[model samples]
Target chain A: GQQVMQIPQYQHVQEGEDFTTYCNSSTTLSNIQWYKQRPGGHPVFLIQLVKSGEVKKQKRLTFQFGEAKKNSSLHITATQTTDVGTYFCASVTSGTYKYIFGTGTRLKVLA
Target chain B: SAVISQKPSRDICQRGTSLTIQCQVDSQVTMMFWYRQQPGQSLTLIATANQGSEATYESGFVIDKFPISRPNLTFSTLTVSNMSPEDSSIYLCSVYGSTPVGNEQFFGPGTRLTVL
Candidate 1:
């Protein structure tokens, strides 16, 4: 069975502080995607990383893929109250299209 | 990105009752998926809706409990049959869309089910 795990189940940061969440897959993944879900909202697509050792950035946020494609990380610089939400990493294995999501990292930024 | 919408943004049902949630996509898509998210928990995939074919369910999920209907590429339905209090959660539908970098998924607002 495939399983995805995330570290630091919950995180609390002061406004303007930096935050990072890690995701790991029990098995190698073909691709990984990041999503953000605001309180009382649906999961929104943030980014997708396909290549191993890939890094993508969105303004104050940075995303990276492990060389083995079994792990990923998302870092948000200068967090704000607007950044409050749960961050999730989803991955699908090769030869299959089903997505398995990690436990997720709940972020709370105190304004 | 595709626009996705779900019916009944929220609902309250009695235990042992069933509820059918509808998912509609603005455009045709090849892949549509159902997911459940409990309060303070991460998303758990329920099944993949195959157009004009039987849906492919994930482990811990069965066709009898969560029957799915893929009438077309743009529409699908997921019925939670004989649901219990444990079944109360946010049900979401997502679709895979083409992107310049690669395929991405877009999710609907989701239906909040509360079983009493």
Candidate 2:
């Protein structure tokens, strides 16, 4: 069985603050993906990391993949009200196209 | 990237009733999937919907409870049969677009089911 876990199940922050969510997998993964779901919205793909020690960024958001490919992180700088949502991390395990998602980190930003 | 649409944005059903959710993709896709998002929880995969063949379900899921039909490459349906209160959740349809860049899955708006 494959399992993906995330930490800081919930976080409350003020505008202009920073936030980070960590994702870990029980087994090695072929690729890792990040998604964000706003209140009452569908899960939207944010980014994907494949190679070990990989780093990618979009605007103020940064994503990193662990050297072992079993962990990943998503960091947001100067968070805004628009950043309020549940961030989920998913890992594609070996021999399957399916993805196992973490419990997710819910971010709450106060203006 | 592809645009996805689902029918019956939300529904209220009595216990033991069933609901069939429809999923349509703008572009043809190879693999389609069904997932459940429980209240305040992560998404759990139900099964992979394949065209012209029976769906391959995941552990803890069965075709008896969640029957799926993929009649074409761009269309699919997931029927939650004889659902209970535990089945009251958001059922989503998703797919990975055919592309050479990478595998990126796009999700539908989801059908919110509330069983009483």
Candidate 3:
């Protein structure tokens, strides 16, 4: 069975602090996606990385895919209260449409 | 990404009962997936629902317990049969398809189930 694990199961940071969550997979993946889930809300797609060692950024957030395509990371710069939520990384293999979700990292930013 | 919706945002049920959750997408899609997130846990895929055929259940999941129906390209249902307290969790419906960025997945507001 394939598994995706995320580091820092929970993170608490002060406003303007930086936070990062790492994701690793047991097997190679074809692509990886990052999602943000607000409290009592659904998961919202953030970004997807397909090429090896690819990096994508959105405003204050940055995403990276490993060269091996088996891991990824999301880094939030100068966090704000609005950034408080859970961040998840989902990976897809070449043969399946199903996503393997990583152990989410719940973020809490204090003012 | 597609706009997806799920019926019965939240429900409370007693043991030994069954509940069916419905999912509808605004546009047609080729595949729909069901996932379960237990309290303080991450998302676990239950099955993949494809149009006009039986669902492909993940390991540790079975059609007998979580029967799925893919009547069309835009709708599906997941029924949790003979429920118990352990069945309490949030069920989510997700769809994957083309988007402006690339092929991506979008999730519906989950159905929160509480079994007692």
Candidate 4:
């Protein structure tokens, strides 16, 4: 079975500090997607990386996919209280479109 | 991404009882899925609901306990039969295949189930 391992299960940071979460898969993935879930809310899709060694950014958030397509990272610069939530990374297996989600990294931003 | 709506946003049920959660998508989709999110835990996939076919459950889930119904392309139901305290969790229904890019699942608000 394929598995995705997320580092730093929980993180707490000051309002202006930086935070980073990593996702590594047991095998190469077809694509990787990132999501953010607010406390007591469902996950919302943020971005997807399909190409190897690709990078995408939104506002102060940067997303990157490893050259092997088996690892990914999300980094936020100068976090805010509104950034508080759990971040998840999902990737499809070699043959299926069904996405397998990581354990998730819960981020807490204090003002 | 697809827009999904799940019914019975929250419920309280007794042990041994059964709970059926409904998921309706705004538009037709190829695949639908059910998930469980325990308090402060990550999303765990329960099954994949396919239109006009039986659902495929994950490793830890079984069809006898969690039966799924996909009567149409836009509507699906997940019945949690014979519940227990461990069944208490937020049940979410999601859909994929509205966008042209790779399949990215979009979830509904979720049905919060509490079994006592």
Candidate 5:
């Protein structure tokens, strides 16, 4: 009975604008992962955060894991049209390998 | 990480018909997961299949509706039985790949199903 909720279910931003999505879980998680699914494409693994309060970055993207491990966030700087997609946060249930995916945030970057 | 391929990239089926989707992994994995994504929706786990063992389905999912077969470590199948319009969705297969940080899931090019 675990649930992962994400804020700003949908976002539209102009090119070069910054965007961020927040994810909150009802239960504690061992680790959290971020994935991006492009239009007409499958989900692609972007990054994973394990340690509490950890932050990782890749180019224009930044990911952070809350200190309690029950929340996470993904931020994109200077967004581009290529950044348009649905971003999802997933976490493995404690003692289980199954992943619980968040509600997902759909991003649309306008040129 | 892991390369996964799925059969029948897209299909249009009539109600009450069944469609079997195949998932093939380039390497052996301990578990393969099936997920359903409705239009503009998030991924919902359908089941987890383990080689040589019965699959473990998630809540609201039943084996009678979505039967799964894991004949080997690198291959699996999911059959959507008695399909309906509401059953139209994208079915994705995923497997975990080991990473220095943690396990990350790699998804195949999902099978898009449209039931009429």
Candidate 6:
């Protein structure tokens, strides 16, 4: 079985501060996807990283995949209150559509 | 991208009872996944349902407790049988597909279940 674990189970940051969450997997992954779930809402697709050692950016957020493809990280700079949510990293099982979600990191940004 | 809707957005049931949650997707998808999110916790996959085949339950989850029915490509149902207080959690349904950006997953609003 594959297991995905995320660091910083919970984080609270002051507005304008930066935040980062790490996702580590027990085995290498073909692709990894990131999701954000707001309070009382469902998880929404954020981005996906496929190639090893890949880096992608969206506005103030940046995503990076490890060269081994066994880990990933999401960093948000100048975070705002609106950036508060639980971040989850997911990867599909080999030869299957089933996705295993990481433990998730809950972010709380203060005003 | 797909539009996913779940029925009974929230419910409160007594112990020993059963609740059936329905998921409807606007487009046909090959695989549908059910997940459980406990309070202040992360998402845990309960099972994966595929059309024309039996659903596959994840580790620690049993078919007898969480029965799933995938009658068609765009519809599925998950029934939590003999519910208990420990079963109180948010049940989410998601579908996987390709989008303009790349392959991704779309989740439903989720059913908030509270077992008394």
Regions of model 3 farther than 4 Å from truth: none
Error of 1 at A35 (Å): 0.6
**Residue-wise lDDT of candidate 6 within A60-111, one digit each (tens)?**
9999999999999999999999999999999988888788889999999999
Worst 10 residues of 3 chain A by lDDT: A91-100
DockQ, per model, reads 0.84, 0.78, 0.88, 0.76, 0.87, 0.86
Shift in Å, residue B2, candidate 1: 0.6
TM-score of chain A of each: 0.97, 0.97, 0.97, 0.98, 0.98, 0.98
lDDT of 2 by residue, B25-79 (tens): 9998889999999999999999999888899999999999999999999999999
The docking quality of candidate 2, as DockQ, is 0.78
lDDT of 2 at A43: 95
Standalone chain B TM-score for every prediction:
0.97, 0.95, 0.97, 0.94, 0.98, 0.98
Per-model C-alpha RMSD: 1.0, 1.1, 1.0, 1.2, 0.8, 1.0
Docking class of 2: medium
Better of 1 and 5 by DockQ: 5
What's the TM-score of every candidate structure? 0.97, 0.97, 0.97, 0.96, 0.98, 0.97
Interface RMSD for all numbered candidates: 1.0, 1.2, 0.7, 1.2, 0.9, 0.8
Interface RMSD of 2: 1.2
Per-residue accuracy of model 5 over B1-116 as CA lDDT, tens digit each: 89999999999999999999999999999899999999999999999999999999999999999999999999999999999999999999999998886789999999999999
Please state the error at residue B14 of candidate 3 in Å: 0.4
Candidate with the larger DockQ of 2 and 3: 3
Give the Cα-based TM-score of candidate 5 against the true structure. Answer: 0.98
Candidate 3 lDDT, tens digit per residue, B22-104?
A: 99999998889999999888899999999988999999999999999999999999999999999999999999878877777
Clashes of each: 0, 0, 0, 0, 0, 0
Model 4, residue A61: C-alpha shift (Å): 0.6
Candidate 5 lDDT tens digits, A1-111: 888999989999999999999999978888899999999999999999989999999999999999998899999999999999999999887788889899999999999
Model 2, A2-52: lDDT tens digits are 889999999999999999999988788888999999999999999888899
Q: How close is candidate 1 to the true structure, as a TM-score?
A: 0.97
**Which residue ranges in model 4 land beyond 4 Å of their true spot?**
B100-102
Model 3, native contacts kept = 0.86
Q: Write the per-residue lDDT of candidate 6 for residues B1-116, one digit (tens) a residue.
A: 89999999999999999999999999999999999999988889999999999999988999999999999999999999999999999999999878877889899999999999
Compose the digit string of candidate 3's lDDT tens values, residues A11-47: 9999999999999997888889998999998889899
User: What is the fnat value (0 to 1) for candidate 6?
Assistant: 0.90
